[model samples]
Target chain A: MGKKTNLVGEIIQDPKVKPLSPHLQVYRPQITSVLSITHRMTGVVLSVGSLGLASWIIAGAFGEQVFSVAQLIISYWISQLLLFAWTLCLFYHLLNGIRHLFWDAGKGLEISQVTWSGWFVVSSACVLNIIFWLIAYGFFAKLV
Target chain B: MAREGVSHWWYQRLTAVALAPLTLWFVWSTIQLMGVDLAGFRAWLSGPVNLVLSTLFVCTLFYHMKLGIQVIIEDYVHDHVLNSLGLIATNIVSVVFCVLTVVSIFVIVFGS
Candidate 1:
């Protein structure tokens, strides 16, 4: 067998070598994997969203005319919806990221703890998002 | 390779720690600045504390973002050429965004 095909041929011929671990599709969806992928998804969203942030700042720097243009775009409902999603993504990523930090420190390795923290992260992120929007709209400010 | 991997891991976590508070502060500041005009917003950002924190936030954010996207590309992009290209793109995007942010902040604070 040639160098490239030698290992493949041997692996195919050997019955004793058990099949590799199941593919991602084979696994039943669980909190751990779901949240893991969600973290990546949110990261991607925030990465793309950073472009808007840079654009906003650049407009502000360019002076009032450009800044107002940005503000006008932002006032659109679609832009507002995107901003809402971005903020929610921000909170989700931030919370899940802290969980990751804890995991890196050798904490929260238990299965039960992982599941509990996963739910906690989701709930807290939602709550924080709501509070953020409230504050943005002056809901809290009016009370003070 | 191992040394580089370790350094990457270390920086990702370190920046994550730094970003947590900075992001929260940013959200809070945004709330406070709601409805302010361009001049008012610029004036607020140019203040000493906001300027420093905003600078740190932008730098750390883009660095962290670059590292995260690099991992995603490494994980999913199977072809060697594409993987390398993805990494390059990630680096360029992050650096450009960071520089743009910092320069904008500088111009707002110091430029006429």
Candidate 2:
């Protein structure tokens, strides 16, 4: 069989495949990796949350009836759970974002410190989210 | 290669620094509005302080989102055409959403 020719036909193509470099599979999971993955995950979550914001704006613009319907949906138990999730996502994204900012500024790139701080940020995000939900529910429970 | 210093990093830090308290206030305001009627919610939002906070929250939130999304696209999307398009689209959407959010705040605060 004739060899396949290309625009540059004189060049011989190498038949052997190059060795694939090690990727995510090779490394042990660590806090920095967890936080890095979570940051992107929460970014996506917040993107979805932005749609909720859009809905709120549109409903508010339309009229009271439409707004009330949205209010009803959002106030439901399941929706409240979603809101809590969204709130957590917000805080996580915010904390990790600050971490990224610090890294960008050429600080905290030390292996030990970076991983330690990543865990700290993640833990702080969880604690803050819990406190926020507690306060929100405390106020909300009063109104009910 | 572009210079490797802390300017971009500083901006992100600054944005997060500003957003910290603003986010807390936003969460509080949103919770306060829970179960309140439309009029009640509107009245709260219409108040000058709430309007200002809401405006700031929306603007900062979109700004942060834009910055984060831009970095993500730059890192993962290798194709020059796709990366540029994604960057542009992200900016456009973020700006439009910010404007819409601000406009809605104004309508709530002043339209009534």
The TM-score leader among the candidates is 1
lDDT of 2 by residue, A1-144 (tens): 576667877644557856567777889987877778888989878976986876686578667898889888988999989988998899888787777767877999999989788888878988988988876678556767
Task: Provide the fnat value for model 1, as a fraction from 0 to 1.
Answer: 0.77
Best by lDDT: 1
Any runs in candidate 1 off by more than 4 Å, and if so which? A1-20, A142-144
Native interface contacts retained, candidate 2: 0.45
Q: Name the TM-score of candidate 2.
A: 0.79
TM-score of chain B of each: 0.95, 0.89
Candidate 1 overall lDDT versus native: 0.91
Cα displacement (angstroms), candidate 1, residue A111, comes to 0.7
lDDT measured at residue A38 in model 1 versus the true structure, 0 to 100: 99
Per-model TM-score on C-alpha atoms: 0.90, 0.79
